[model samples]
Target: MNSAVSFFYFLSFLTILSAVMVVVSRNPIHSVLYLILTFFTLSGHYILLNAQFLAAVNIIVYAGAIMVLFLFVIMFLNMKQDQEESKTNLTKIAATIVGGTVFVILFGAYRKTAIEPFNPQTYDSQIGMIESLGHMLFRDYLLPFELASILLLVAMVGAVLLGKREIGERHF
Candidate 1:
């Protein structure tokens, strides 16, 4: 196989493994760390797909900034590692059945769709460069981009408000 294909497989494996670790890890900190690793692996996959800008943004936004915020919240909460009791065996069985059903349905839907086969020769085109992405984001996705910034601002404000503790008597 070609080097590109080999790299893609390796990155895919790393991403999947890290994602699984994120969910399976007992400690919340370890889960967050695994999630960061998964994001980094996903960034590598984006780089392999010739999306350098996307890869850098993924690392900056998800792996760096978002993960830092998550870590801070986790630390602030000072949660302890405790053995969580399962609700019931029936509940576990039901959840497993539902999850399996959803997975099968999604897989079947994906298989039914006509996916365009990848052609390595098409890699010559600079499709995922910063300039091209900037153009599209500014022209086609400007509204959504602005909305996302607004959403993030709201979330930041909400987090601060939620974390603030009342220190004085209530005023009329």
Candidate 2:
């Protein structure tokens, strides 16, 4: 295949592998690292799609800032390896059924929609520029943008609360 296609596949593989690792890793620190790798791979995909602004934000916001905060919270909490727990067979079966149902529903929903062919010549390259993205975010999507920021703030506050130690608790 062409170089671009090959690179896309490589990024996709890395993204999927890291995402799975994030889910399966026993150590929280290792999971967070894998999650960062997944974010980097996603940013690479955005670059390949020619959404430079998105790629930059993905790296700066997710990999740079959010991950730092996540790591800080993890360290501050002084988390330990979780105790092993086994799920009953019925619980596992129920989870699998629920997951399969959700997957089938999502697949059917997307299958009904038609994908448009890509046309590079007619694409508005300026649309993905920082200036244009800023204008759209501030002018057209101001409410949604502000809402997202508020949501992020609430999440951070929640994280801090969760990480805060209770009085008289042993550090161990």
Candidate No. with top lDDT: 2
Give the Cα lDDT of each candidate: 0.89, 0.91
Show where candidate 2 strays beyond 4 Å. Answer: 76-82, 86-94, 146-172
Q: Give per-model TM-scores.
A: 0.75, 0.71
lDDT by residue for model 1 over 1-172, one digit each (tens)? 9999998998899889999998788788999999999998998988887899999999998888989999999989776666455547999899999989999999999999997787987655577999998988999999999999999999999999998777894756
**Candidate 2 per-residue lDDT over residues 1-172, each given as its tens digit:** 9999999999999999999999889887889999999999999998887789899889999999999999989878776665434556888899999989999999999999999887989978788778888999999999999999999999999999999999999898
Error of 2 at 10 (Å): 0.8
Error of 1 at 136 (Å): 1.3
